[model samples]
Target: MIEILNPTLLARARETGALVADILDTLRSRCAAGTNLLDIDRWAKALIVEAGAVSCYVDYAPSFGRGPFGHYICTGVNDAVLHGRPYDYTLADGDLLTLDLAVSKDGVAADAAISFLVGDARDAESVALIETTERALAAGIAAARPGARVGDISHAIGTVLGEAGYAINTDFGGHGIGSTMHQDPHVPNAGRPGRGYTLRPGLLLALEPWVMADTAQLVTDADGWTLRSATGCRTAHSEHTIAITDDGAEILTLPRRAREL
Candidate 1:
């Protein structure tokens, strides 16, 4: 289902988006060597509850996933990329970690993700992968304007990833989000411009650009939720929720500090 937020709901969306961004930023700062993934989930739950918000993940049972997600946040480590279920794993120095989160507040929802290294040992390949995804995400956001087709955003994102020498995966990508975590108008990472659903004011979209270091294939972990690189290569993911407006796309999920000034 695709939802176009009215002004009031859009205001709530901004609040929810800021909350999601703040939580992710806090989690990223708290993560370090020896940090347990479960601890991250716990921290996320505590914050969400304190804010009187609802987790879009926990109790989520989608056709693509096994059962209820049962976690407050997604913890993707090293080879893990999407739908990473929190486990007993402790982060190690230089470990690439991706944290994806979505939540609803005031009857509105926003989703975002971030990828970073665990410690000081940032491998060259890992740094490059993370940077590429960030750039692709930026490109996608830049293309999200009223009247632009979803394909324009996808094409912009794909251009960056393809030029960076990473294969693109279309199975799972960005999608319309509002009131709910995932919605209609599936936004692939790559597509031809001037195609797909046209953008309009009040439309909300979660634009995510993710890539594996070597291949485009993915393998599901034994947990039935975590998606890892088929070749076990390191991966990175970056995402943000944006609202299309008359001027352009307004990024609702920017960090609180960034939004403040």
Candidate 2:
């Protein structure tokens, strides 16, 4: 279901977006060597409850995943990329971690994800992977606007990742988000420009650019949720929820502190 949020709901979306971003920022700050993935999930749950927000993931039951995610946040480590279910694993120094979150406030929802190193980042490859995903996400946002097509955004993101020498995966990508977490039109990480749904004002899109260092193939972990790189290569993912407006795309999921600045 595609939704074009009205102004009132859009306002709520911004609020939810801020909450998601702030929680992510706080989690990132708390992450360090010896931090357990399950602990991160607990922290996220606490923050979400304190904010009086509803988790979009905890009770989520999608066909692609096992029923009821039962986790507040996704914790992807190193080779793990998408749908990373939080588990009992201690983060080591230089471990690449990706945290993906979504929440609803006042009946409106927002989603976002970030990838960073656990401690002092010594792996050049990990740093580069994270940077490339960030750049790709920016490129995708830049291509979003009223009258622009979804493919344009996908193409822009693809150009950045392709140039960075990372393999793109289309099975899971960005999508329309509003009252619910995931909606249509599916926004792939790579696609041809001038194709797909045309953008319009009031449309909310979650643009995510993710890549694997070596291959595009993915293998699901035993948990029946976490998706990892088929070749055991490290991966990185970056995402943000944007609202299409007359001027351009307004990023809704930027941290409150960042928005203040």
TM-score of each: 0.99, 0.99
RMSD of 2: 0.7
Query: Candidate 1 has which clashing residue pairs, if any?
Result: none
Q: What are the RMSD figures for all models against the true structure?
A: 0.6, 0.7
- The Cα local distance difference test for each model comes to 0.96, 0.94
The sequence of per-residue lDDT tens digits that candidate 1 reaches over residues 174-229 is 99999889998999999999999989999999999999999999999888899999
In candidate 1, where is summed lDDT lowest over 10 consecutive residues?
115-124
> Which 10 consecutive residues of model 2 have the lowest summed lDDT?
118-127
**lDDT value, residue 47 of candidate 2:** 99
